[model samples]
Target chain A: MEYLSMLPGPTNVPNRVMRAMLAPIINHRSDDFVELYTDVVDKTQQVFQTKNDIVALSASGTGAVEASVINIVKKGDKIIIPVNGEFSGRLAELIEAQGAHVVKLQTPPGQNATFDQVKEAFDNNKDVKAFYVVHNETSTGTMVNYLDRISDLTSRNDSMYIVDSVSILGGVNLPVDKWNIDVCMTGAQKAIAAPPGISPISVSPKAKKYMIANPPPTMYFNLARYFKYYEESKHTPFTPALPLLYAYREALSIMLEEGLEHVFKRHKVCSDALYSSLSAIGLTPFAKQEDRSISIIALNYLDGLEDKIFRDTLADKFKVLVAGGFGNLKGKVFRVGCMGEVNKYHVMRTVSAISSTLAMMGYKTDAQAGLKTAEEKLKAL
Target chain B: MEYLSMLPGPTNVPNRVMRAMLAPIINHRSDDFVELYTDVVDKTQQVFQTKNDIVALSASGTGAVEASVINIVKKGDKIIIPVNGEFSGRLAELIEAQGAHVVKLQTPPGQNATFDQVKEAFDNNKDVKAFYVVHNETSTGTMVNYLDRISDLTSRNDSMYIVDSVSILGGVNLPVDKWNIDVCMTGAQKAIAAPPGISPISVSPKAKKYMIANPPPTMYFNLARYFKYYEESKHTPFTPALPLLYAYREALSIMLEEGLEHVFKRHKVCSDALYSSLSAIGLTPFAKQEDRSISIIALNYLDGLEDKIFRDTLADKFKVLVAGGFGNLKGKVFRVGCMGEVNKYHVMRTVSAISSTLAMMGYKTDAQAGLKTAEEKLKAL
Candidate 1:
């Protein structure tokens, strides 16, 4: 049974993208692969809205995030990470693992770090090497709404601005170049609608310069090696996951064909519909209105509604698979992904399924009202 | 045109394995994913022939090798790596990147590090932390044939025995437990015939203890985190490449169904055919017969045969893709993969293709004789 994936990532891959995986494997060093890889990288740069070189890594999103950190942050380097959710907190830990002194600007799980908070962190810390932040905190369904504003502080301080846009990039407007983002990493499975595994990360020339000067003592996650290989042969340093590359190329083509404006607008409509519909069904939105994620929709569990039972019922009965919360929010919030190939049909079915599941769990919810609300919002798509 | 992949890795994925990737994405934390992941790990362990725990990392073969090295070798740790081929040399570099003192046992290309040479290294270096070797060096088509014996040396010295069996595990008999290999890593694409990306690595209890005692400062490649996640739920530390996992599971299923003994025998017969046929066509085998890789057959280019022109003719004219030699052997040798789904038909087709390509290049070669030789050897399969 194929349950609808409504989790934050590894979302419902479109048939076009999934079918692309059926293409025969090709030699990564071959001309055909060079063409496929170059095209994928170019399309990835377009989606990132950056002129920076993109490296398609054959690892998960976390690997790319690690690459972004280990490449720039050396020992004793002070790096500021605004931790608002599980993903951001993990990023801080990853930086600390590099022997860097992480100055974390802690925020409540449901809220994002404001520009003022980050600016103050920059002011407090001297010679900060980098500012790392998760653009979209999938765990809490919160997004930093002030990244464009915060980029200014990093720019003024001359610190590398690294953004983990794993859950947001293709679905949201993240202009890496405009924001002066030195490194922006994203997973293929998220808004890109490709299969999981490949993470296409955009690296600015500044970041590349820093990395080449102080190369990480790593082989597989070494960004400098990727740059060298890309420059020399339009190839990854290692054998890439060829099928995922194919799927990613196709997914990016779909995104480009629809136009980034339309893709971002569709994501906005879908997430809006989810938020409004779930809110109407007596489920409170987890994040504050101003900071809610436009990709992952997080909702507080209704009073007396069991978390496992609710999700289980949704999966087993409705075949709609949603995610329970992570860390502190576990059993308190449920997350539904509104990114990646999500359309009016998906939004409507998800709203109806949640409504029906909650009602089945003996919660007071109007299924018709939820569906109508979702239908109205999705009309924008 | 879909050229047949005969490279050392990213081999021709079977249609069943490729189609398995079309399965819709699922939540990594879900029970369904747990089932899928657990089964894949179990089958991977079977291929590895190990009773140890297997960590299926969502990275390439090199990433797994990096994980194995970084997890165990701390700063200033002395690790002996035999450098005979490109892969082994890279392994030494990865170990060195971890700030470990790499004592390289340098052997010429197309030759394996003898048991005596490794023993000499261990004797000379006191308190050696580990002994790393590439079981099948794909770049030079050479394999260390004394791993079982070398494992004893590491066991006696209480050093970790790490083996990079990335290109040969499924198609060859590598009993990790029997050989006392502390860390054995293999990629899914090579021999396993799954699409590349996921690298399933087996860790013995001893290696795990050492890793837990001295954890690497890494997030994504952290083996400890993987252990914790697998213990809590049959899940990886982060989101896995779901479609690749599906393909890996199907590929493993095919391997298990065929039985390891039969698989190993088939690989032996296939390589035997390639060796006899290609040798008959006047292309000398690059690796000495004693140390040659059974999975990757490396043959020297005939005198006056241009490497690019020969391989191009093979690819364009006959729709067969083979690899050129690496490093010093570039343009000197050609490699054909005789692993995974490679049977009598592929053997005959490849032999005929090579012979005809050589003939087309104005070289003296008997295509009929090569085909007949391949047919005679493939009868064993």
Candidate 2:
């Protein structure tokens, strides 16, 4: 059975990308594959808006996070991480796993880190050599808007500014070069509209030099090794996921065709329509409008309904797959992904499905009203 | 124009697997995804012929190699690595990168290590805690035939045994339990016939305990952490490459339906036919009879023809992709892989392409005679 993927990642891939992905495999070291690899890297750099070298690894986005930490941070080096949601929480765990000291500036669930909190943490931790922050928190649908300020703070102190834009890379306003992101990373499956298994990471010379001085106890996800291999030959150290690379190249082409600014505007429209439609059905977004994500929307259905029951009913009965809350936000919220190739119609279908499911479950929801609101919003956009 | 992939690992994926891979993405944390993940792991264990639990990582096979070394071998632990081919040489490098003491028992580029050499290395290295070997060296087309005997030697010496079956997993005969292999790893892009990006690893209880006792300085490739996640949640700690997993499940289903022994037999037939046909076209197999790969064949066109010229002509004119050698064997040998989802027709096409390219290069080659030999050999099989 087919289901509409509305999760924060692994969203519905377009047929164009699927056809490219199913193309016959090519030898990775072949000239044809070098063209594909180099094109993808160049396109990725454009999307990242940086002159920093981009290295694609056959790994998940978390693997890229591990690569950034293990490569740049020396052992026992203190890194200030702003914890806002599930993904940001995982950053702490990943840093600790790599034997680095993590100074976490905690924020409430479904909220972004305030400037005061971030500045206070920076002032308190003078030994911090790096600042890692999640640009888009996938769990609670929050996006940090103070990243440029944070980058300025890090640069003034001569520290690295690393950003995790896994969920909002192509769908939101993230200018890596403008913000001077020393290291920024994203996964292909999230906002790139490609199948997963490929992580595209950008590394400036500062991060590269730090990595050369303090190498990680890693070989596969070693950023410098990837850089060396790319510099020598436009190929990964190992045989990469060739099919996925095909899909990634095609997806990036699609995004570029639409243009990044227009893509971000479309996502904002989709997110706004979803909010209006969901509110028509008595469901409210979890995060504030300023900190809310254009890539995803987290909704609260608090009329004596369990989060699993709501999401499971929507998935099994309506064939719409949304994600349940994770970590500390479990049972409080459910997320709908609006990234990738999702259009207004996709968001409309999700909103319609949710309204129908709520009505079926005896919750107070007007399916027709929700559909009308969504259609009007889409038409206005 | 479409090309026939003849690389060592990124081989030709079957149409069935491709169609499955093009299926829409799903929520990875959903029950449907869990079913898919667990079934793939089970089938992987069966293909490995071991009851050990399978840990599938959404990374390249190199990530699995890093996991085996960093997780199982402690810092400063001595490991006995016999470097013969490019892959085995890479094993030594990976071990050394993890701060392990590598005792290299080196062999010639195109030769397999003898039993005496392997035994003498273990006998001399008293502090060796592990012995890692590549079952099928993809570069020189050498398969380690004396693995069971080597397993016995390692067991008697109280050291762990790890095998890398990256180039020849499902198409070759590898009895992990019967050979007492502590940790055996294979990539999805090899004989498994799936798209690249997933590494399936089978680990015994002994290796698990050792890893739990001494955790590696890793987060992404940490086996015990993966084990714990699998034990509790039956999911990867990070977002996996979902489409590749779908492709992997379908490919494993195809292999199981064909039966492992029949699969192995078919590979042997194809390899034999390719070897005979290439010989008819004035190419000599690189390795000895017993050590030659049943899944891949490396040939030396030893009439002073540049490797690049031959491979490039074949690829450009006939649209057939072959591999140039790596490490010390570079520019001396070319390789053709006849693993997973490959048949006699594929072999015939490859052999014909090589002969035609040689003929185009003003070399002595009997194109019709090679085709005739390949047909006769295939008919006999």
- DockQ of all predictions against the true structure, Cα-based: 0.82, 0.72
Best by DockQ: 1
Model 1 residue A53 CA deviation in Å: 0.4
Per-residue lDDT tens digits for candidate 2, residues B190-246, read 898898888899999998888878877667888888888889888887888888888
**lDDT to native, each model:** 0.88, 0.85
Model 2 DockQ (Cα-based): 0.72
Model 1, A248-348: lDDT tens per residue?
99999999999999999999999888988888877789899999999998888888788999999999999998899998999999999988888998888
- Candidate 1 is scored at a TM of 0.98
lDDT of 2 by residue, A1-381 (tens): 688888899888888988998677877887777889999999999899988989887888888888887787776888999897778988888788767888888878778878888888888877689999998999999988888788767976778899988888998878888988999999999889898888899999888887767666667877777788888988778888888889899999999999998888888888888988898878889998788888889998666888878888988898999888887777888889998987887888898899888888888777887888888888755
lDDT tens digits, residue span B1-381, model 1: 677778888888898988888777878888888889889888888888888999988889998988988888888999898898888888888888778888998988998778888888888886998888888998889977787787768877878888899999888888989989999999998898888999999999988987888888888888988898888877888888889899899999999999999999999999999999888888789998899999998888877788899898999999999999887889999899988888888888888888888878788887777888888888897
CAPRI-wise, candidate 2 is: medium
